[model samples]
Target: MGSRRTFSRRLGVPGRAGVALFAAGLGLMSPFAAAPASAQTADAPAGTWATPPPLGPGDAPPADSGHPDTTYKKKNECVQRSLGQDVKINFRPWGQDYLQLDRAQQIVRAATGSVGGNQKVAVIDTGVTPHPWFQDRVESGGDYVATPDNGAQPGMQDCDGHGTEVAGIIAGNPKDPQVGFIGVAPDARIVSYRQLSENYAKDDSPQQPSAPPSGGTGAPPSGGESQQPPAGGSSNSQLPPSSGGGTGSGSGTAPQQDNKGDSRDLAKQGTAGTLNTLAQIIRGIADTHRAGVINMSVDHCRPGTAPGDIQEGERKVQAAVRYAADNDIVVVAAAGNVSENCPQNDQADPNKPKSIVTPPWFSDDVLSVGAIQEDGGVAPFSVHGPWVGVAAPGTKIVSLDPAEHSNGLANLTIANGNPSPIQGTSFAAPYVAGVAALVRSMFPHMKARDVVKRLKATAQHPAAPGGRDNFVGYGVIDPVAALTANLPGDTGNLSLPKPVVQEAKLPPADGISSTPMIVALAGTGGGVAALLITLFVMHTIRRNRARSSPPTK
Candidate 1:
C-alpha cells in the first residue's frame, strides 16, 4: 500500500493517516518501533500535531478542585476533527434496516408498557454529539478527554467525531417522514461518557526520559497468549482490554496493509482512551447507577507480547467488567479491529488470541461484539478471538454526525479530504449495545449475565464447531429475537411470577358406568376368539404330527 492510512473507528474507524512517528525533541519513539512485523501508532485521528493553544488566564481549574497549581506545560496537540460527510436526512442506513428494530420495539413496548421504561445505555467513547436525531435523549455522563482543561462541558464535545457515531446507533430516533432509520431501541436514553478521544495525546517530553537508551522496544510475542500496552502511554494499543489508560504517540488516519493486495483500512485512531481509564469509567458507571448498559467501542491493542505477561491495565478492566455485571449493568465492547499495529488472531489457538482486545477479553463479564459486512459475512478487518460473543453489521455504517451545532446525519467520514464509508468493529459494538438496551428495557428484572446470555442465544449462530468461531462468535445479533424469544432453562432473570400449586376444582371427569365398560371391553373380543380358534386347530395338527414323527436326531 502506498500510504497505510487505517481508519476503521477505535481499534478505530474514521480519520487516521500515516504512522505517528516520535515528534522531534520528544527524544522517544513508539514502544513497538523495533518490531519488524508491527507498526507503532495510537488510534488518534488525522490531525497535524498542534497542541491546544496555551491555557488562558481562567483555563486553570479552580484551586479548590485540586491541591497542585503547576504551570501549564504544553504538549503535542492534535487538532481534532468535528465534521463528517452530511448525508440526506431521508436516507436509511442498511444496518438498522437489517436489524428489524421496529419489530423488536413493538414487542418490548419500551414507551407504552411500563413506568421508567426507557433503559439508559452509557456510551464510553468520544463524547456524543447533540444531534437532533437524538431528540434530547443524550445525557452528559463525564469527560475524561476534554474537561476542566479545555473548559468543554463534560461528555458534551466529540473532538474526535467518533463517540457521536457510536451513540447514534444505540438511541438515534429521527421522526422525519418516510425515514427507515431508527435506533435498536429508540426509547432507550443514552448517557454519554467521553472516556477517550483521539484528539488528546500523552506528553512524553524529553524531561521525563522514561524510555531507556536502548529504546526498550519489544516485538509482539509469538506465544499463545494475549497482549496489551502498559498503562503509562500509548492507547489501549488494541483490543481484548478496555480503552487503555495512557495512550502513546497517536497514529495518523491512513491505511496500512497487513500482507499483500489488502484494501480494508485497519488504522486505529489515537485517543486519550486507555485500558485503566476504561476500567475506571466502567466502575464509575456501576457506582453512579447512571445506566443499565455500557457500550465501549474503544480498545487498547498491542502486538502479541510475552506469554503469561498480563498488563495491570488489562486486569483492571477485567475487574471493572465484573463490577458492572455484579451491579446488574450489561457491558458491551468492540472486538478490536485489525491493523498493522494489531494483527489478526487467526494464528492463535481457539481460546488464546495473541492480540487480546479488552473488556472483550474479559468475556465472562462482558459481551464482546465482532463486526460483519453488509452481506452478513464477517468483516475482514474484524479481529478474531475466543472472547467474541456475537457479531453485528459494521461495514458501511451511517449514524449521527459529530460536527458541532449540527442536526444532520452522516454515512461517511473524510480522511485526507477523501470520503470513505464509515466502517469498523467500533460501530458494531454500538449495535449490540442498542440491542442490549432493548433487552434491558423489555426484561426489566433480567440479571445482567442473563442479558448477555440471551444475546448469544438469539444470535444468528455460525456454522463453525459449537456454533461459533473466533471471528463472528455466536454469529450476528438478532434484535427481534433478543427482545421476544423464550429460552430453555431461562431462570437467569425473567422475574416471572412463581407458579402456584393448587388442587383442581371439584368437578370430576365424566366416565362410563361399569356395565358400559364391560360392553366396551367385550366389543373387542372377536379378534381374541378368532385367535383362539386358530390356536386350537394348530394344536390338533401338532398332536397328529407328534404321533407320526417319533424321534429325529
Candidate 2:
C-alpha cells in the first residue's frame, strides 16, 4: 500500500472527519511502514514499530474530535421534554418505544436466559465505565492511547461518554427495573479497549504561532478549527465511581492561550501520532484470542476524497481486521452518518473512482451497520451503499449515563439517573454487535462468517422495491429470528453442496428432422426426375426423325 491521504468522519457530526490526524510539521510517516534493518532483530517482537521519543508538550499532537461531544442537544430527542415556566424536564426514556423492546423481551423470556451466556464482545472505542447497571459484566482489556510520560491513565475510562453508551446498549443489565434501560444482550460480557485518546475532542487554534520555538529557527504552522465529536456518548452526566476519570493525558485541559508560538506545531504532531497509535491498538485487538465479536462504532472519512482510495492509516486498520477475521473474530462497524451513498460518487470529484469511508469499507468480513428510524425508514443521516450489511435502530436510543458530572456539559435526565438519548450509526452498530453476541453464545461452534450469514439471512426485510436494498441492506435485524431460526446451509459441515446432474434425453432412433430440411430433399428428388424424363422424350423424337427421312443424312 502506497501512503495515500485519507480523512475521518464522525458518526453523528455531519460534514467533518470522525478522527483527523495532522502531520504538518512532522513528516507524515506510515504507521505500518517497515522498520529499518538496524531496528529489527530475530529476538524482537513480531509486529513492533520503532519507538519514537515520548511526545512532550512541544510534541503533543493537536486532538481532533473522534468521539461525539455529548454536551450538545441530541439530534433526534428520544425522551419528550416538558417546558415549565422556569425549568425544563425530561419525562421518560422513549428508546423502548422506537426499539420495540417488548418484542425483544418476549424472545428473551421464551429463550429462558439461554442467550449471551459467556460471549465476549470487544468494544474498540473510547473507554467504557463500569456502571451499576452492568453488574460487574464490563471487563478492562487495556488502554492503547496511554504512554509512560504522557500522564495517561490505564484501564477503560470514558472521559467522553461514547464508549460507556455503546457498552450499555450491548450488555447493560435488563434486571435493573428502576433504570428501565435494557441492553440487547443483557447477559453478554463486555471487554473494553480504549483505542482513542481521552483528548480526542480537543482542537488547536487556527491562528499561526506568533514566534518560533525558543531554540528553533522556523515559525510554527497554523492550526484548524475544532469540531464537535460524533453522536452516541453519555450526556454530561456525572461519572460513576466505577467509571474512571480521563486518561490523564492533557485531554481534559483547554487549549493553551499563552503557548501560541508552539501550539500548532505540537497539535500537528499529536494528531499524526494519534493515527499511528490507533493502528497499533487495532493490531493488538486482533492478537487477542478470547474476543468473539468486536464492535467498532467509529468511522473515518476524508472530506472531498473518493471512497475506495486507501489511506496509509486505513490500510493498517484493514490489515488488523483481516488478522482478526482469520482468528475467527467477527468485526462490526458503523456505516458512517454521512447522507451520501458510500462507495459511490464523490460529487467533489465526479470523475474520480467511487470510494467509501474506511474500516467498514475495508473488507466484506467487517459487518457495516446503517441506522434506521422508528418508522422503518433509513435515518436521514445514515450513509447508504452496497457495503451496508444490516440496519438497526439508531434514532433517539436511550442507554446508560456516567454518574459523576465531570464535564458539566449538556446532561439530559431520563430514568436510571441521567440516562441520555443518543442518535447515530455509532449506536446502531452496537445493536448488531449485541445480537452477534447472542448468536455466538447460542451457537459456539459456528464460524465468524457463518454467524454473520445467519444474522443477515434472518433479518426482516422492509417493504422496499427489493427485499434487500442499499439503504437498509437486508432491512432491520430481527433478534428473535436471528436467535431461533435455522438458516440455510448452516450445518456444521463445511462441505460444498453436491452438483445436480440431469440425465440427458437421447433423440429418436430414426433421427431428428426439421420441416425445412424435409421440404428441400423432396424438391431435389422431383427436379431430377423431371430432367431425366425430358431427356428421354428428346432422344425418342430424334430417333423417329432419323428412321423416316434423314437416314441418308
What lDDT tens digits, residue by residue, belong to model 2 across residues 1-553?
A: 1122223232342233223333321222431223233211101122212111121343221232333222111111111111111121122234454556557656755655644757888887656756666778888776654321213234355534456767878987746344455777887888886655323323344652332111101101111101011112233333222222111111122221121111111112232123444445455656656579989876664433432344555555666666677678888988766522233332342223243555665435578888877677777667655556788987655556532222111122222122223467777898899888877776677898888777776777644423455567666787777766754477453234566998898876885668879899899999999999999999999989878875454
Local distance difference test, per candidate?
0.59, 0.52
Model 2 residue 248 CA deviation in Å: 17
Clashes of each: 56, 21
**Would you give me the overall lDDT of model 2?**
0.52
Instruction: Indicate which candidate wins on TM-score.
Output: 1
Worst 10 residues of 1 by lDDT: 221-230
Task: In model 2, state the lDDT of residue 109.
Answer: 51
